[model samples]
Target: MAFKYSGSICSDLDKIRVFIDEILDKLNSIIKDQDTMFDLKLILNELVINGVFHGNECNNNKCVRLYLEVIDNIVRIEVEDEGKGIDYDISSYNSAELKCCGRGLIIVNGLSDEFYVKKNKVIAVKRIN
Candidate 1:
């Protein structure tokens, strides 16, 4: 059976760290690789922060949904925020442009085996082989 977990958070950034750790602990029980765990942690952190800060704009009224699943050795993560969403393309973020502030998606896209954005949501997939 596939392991699955779903959680929601407000716009508070402080809660993010705790949430990440909780989710990571659950994932760790199923995923034994240190490298995979580290990468997953990074991916989750970046996506959740973006959802809370950028997507929800630190508005306490808004919420961010986090979904995680492990099936067939593939880890799937989805984060959605209650906001208007963004229009920037991940491909447009050049590493050379270090001064920009929208590099989170760029890093996420690079790290995850497959990732995409839908409205105010980001979906990322990574193989844990």
Candidate 2:
């Protein structure tokens, strides 16, 4: 079976949880593994939070576009924001820094099988068991 979700959500922090729950509901049947689901949830949270805080600068007027697709054992996630594109290199991000902030991309990169940023969109791919 295949599942997909392509939609836009307001850049409101309060709506992120509801959006994630809806996505999880859609993915429950296709992804039965608890660990995978947990990882996906974390990934979604990080990406959406980044889009709201960094990309959109917490602007409620802007919207974040999300694309989620699960085909067989592979799952793909994409998030796009309305603000300017990324300025730095994502691959060179240092997760070991002693800072308290800016670890979202690092966490997403570690959990995802493949992660990349293009323009205003960030994409992550994971293989489920």
Question: What TM-score against the true fold does each predicted structure earn?
Answer: 0.94, 0.92
Report the Cα lDDT for residue 59, model 2.
Answer: 97
For candidate 1, lDDT tens digit of each residue in 59-123? Answer: 98988999999997999999999989887686677678694468878878888999989889899
Q: Which ten residues in a row have the lowest lDDT in candidate 1?
A: 91-100
Candidate 1: which stretches are off by over 4 Å? none
Query: Which candidate achieves the best TM-score against the true structure?
Result: 1
Q: Please report, in order, the local distance difference test score of every candidate based on alpha carbons.
A: 0.88, 0.88
Candidate 2 per-residue lDDT, tens place, 3-122, comes to 889998898878888988888888887788999999999999999889988899999999999999988889999999998978647656666775545578888988999999887899
